[model samples]
Target chain A: MLTGMTAKEVAKMVKNKEDLFILDVRNQSDYQDWKIEGEKVSSINVPYFDLLDGVEGVLKQLPTDNKLLVVCAKEGSSKFVAEQLVEAGLQDVSYLEGGMKSWSEHLEQVLVYADEQLKVYQYLRMGKGCLSYMVISGEEALVVDPSRFTDVYMEAAKQEGAKITHIVDSHLHADHISGGKTLADQTGAAYYMMKSEGAVFDFMPFEEHDRIRFAHVDLRVLAVKTPGHTPGSVSFFVNDKLLFSGDTIFVGGLGRPDLGGKVQEWAKDLYDTVYEKIAAMADDVIVLPGHYANLDQEVNAAGYVGAELGAIRAGNELMNQQDKQAFVDQVVANAQTETPPNFEEIIAINRGVDVASPERQQELEIGPNRCALHHTH
Target chain B: MTSNKFLDAKGLACPMPIVRTKKAMNEMEANQVLEIHVTDKGFKNDLTAWTKSTGNELVKAEEEGDVLKFWIKKGE
Candidate 1:
């Protein structure tokens, strides 16, 4: 979807260039098999296959100028990188028309990699009728909005041979008592919550763009200032690739906003977050959302857990609405208005004040807290 | 030339007119004068800074009705 050049035009450039920089963003194995063999062609192994986990450091390594030619195995990955570079105000950027596959066929080029390695994990976590995750790197891992059952985290740590060094609450969760504080206490990890939560609930605070270091790994958990589901609601971003969308954004859907009084304001924030912030990233990002709304259906299924960031951009039918005004109108016209009476109780649980006894923690989290958008029938 | 290449940059957002004018100048010959029109209250100061940066000559800059026009020469 880039403008100004076609496949044949780029092919011509690769053939005749005396000095040009060709960058391959594919894994090392693909690079070793076939690549455009002319001038100074280099490959950086940024393996974000199946899931988009780490790419921030890779983006920093790219040159801002001098006719950068980006290539990948298929055009999908490299095209995504080129668009991101353009957004960052880089000039003279273009991706190979058909990625390496086409280049290998047409240019008869050789792909070479010093060492080709890719890490792909299909299922992050699966428990008794629940799917959760402990995203880790090196000696540190983050336990996100965990259920009261604390053993899940410990077991995950035991499996990975890493310590749970950080506990993050996506939002003031109502589905279950947040295990953030408990996990922090046991592991001696810091409990991180959005700064906005200070006004809504008196608790330890963190602000936007705050970088929390865990062991040798630096996990910059961004507090995306999203309000409305509750005024203090926030989402977490790790390395700008994985968006731990609490209740605000779901896979193929959005968070229920009736928890707080400002239904109008909440809808507005959701609009800005979806269209402005989330939409601005590369298409290949992996979106790991907070909740999957499949509990009510008879079939009972896994929530829309993770999705390709590209698929959302090409597919979000509702993102075209121009501004905050149109977004509120659209949400009000099509949102569920029911809220739970026990929402305050749930908020207390999220605040860690209404914490359950060791034996009763498992019973409190029946479903998500009954809030304004979701209710107990 | 009478600086007849008029650019109506009135009401356009910041840096847009400058970016467009830069593009236009890149395609035009040096010494071709460009007449730029802008309505933003800040355009007077914006044009001053831009001309200084690009080393272009601002021949005449003033307000007419709701728009401000700046006649700039492409300095060789």
Candidate 2:
């Protein structure tokens, strides 16, 4: 009998580095563009059209001993194919529930920090590498850089016996759609963002309020009006304990400044932000970033994607450039020119300048994140 | 712009449009055009890639509100 597996269960298998085999049934180009990836995930692509008649042709390529997963764009085809595999005497055959679309939107929530005063949780978007966060204190919670799944945050807030009172978008995201506005609307939370991001929606600008104090959050701006890749990029310094670095800094490298076509100016501003604004913080402050590239390399033993400010500074040679010119030059030279797939549409929808159906949004966001590039490599 | 045959694949799900198109093309002569209309949004990319890999020519592809139209010329 064939069974269906949720994305969350598959995420656990990937987390444990379990040996698995994935037979992706989407078109060749679709599979080549973006698909599930992990250190232990071994997969192959055979277009769904080829298997409509039967599954006998591809059986030779299947590994009988490995955990077999059939995947497609939606759950329909995978289930259809998995049934055929079962009839062909394959054991332990299963399909991904809701298919790649569900996998794309699946978030693995991991607790990052907790104390008597506050508790923090990080939601890692397993497929897209996008990271969102929530901080609970007293009877209120503050969500930072939420993804499109508003219910996940709202539901999580309820489970913690707290209400979502504040929502912040660290910057105008280019890779994925921001759930800040939707989440705020659903929970009656005060939405915050930079006014210069050109959002048409009502939001509390970070410029007017230097400090957003509620329950226990003394959220202060470390850097606003960045004028880097995105003009309104702001870093949230939470209670002077954790730094929500946004896209400005990553565990592997700095956020590439070439997205806005003014690499020189952006790179210079990034230099100032790094050397002037962020460097003042002590080494022990944990840096929670907006996105990650390699999970194994970026995630710490604590099961979250963050690092100590001191370790990030001491480890990366790019952070030690004393001369502004050399640092700017290096940032410009090392920047990745490839922009995120369908960024224009995603940005327009995020800015509230346009709207799309849920299907359209998922179609637009079906690819890997290209926002962070290593300044070193 | 002109096709010798028409294949209406509207309302079909994954693999159906491509599956029908392949069958229709097999019965066509070399250089004959096969016009297909599909509702699956993903078929846009699939048709483009399918034509390229199968050595067929995609004469034109356009969207009409909810439907995607394609013209594939069978290759020898």
lDDT of each: 0.55, 0.86
Give the worst 10-residue stretch by lDDT in candidate 2 chain B. B44-53
lDDT of 2 at A3: 94
lDDT, candidate 2, A1-377, per-residue tens: 79999999888887777887999988888798778777788999987777877999999999999889999988877888889999999998999998888998999999999988889999999888899999999999999999999999999999999999999998888889899988988899999988878899999988787578888778897653654345525688898899998888888768777466878877777778888888888999999998888877888988789999998888878888569998888877887778889999998998999998888889888877877534343
Candidate 1 CAPRI grade: incorrect
True contacts kept of each: 0.00, 0.57
Model 1 Cα lDDT, one tens digit per residue, A103-123: 422211111111112111112
- For every candidate, the chain B TM-score is 0.85, 0.96
Clashing pairs in 2: none
Q: DockQ score of candidate 2? A: 0.63
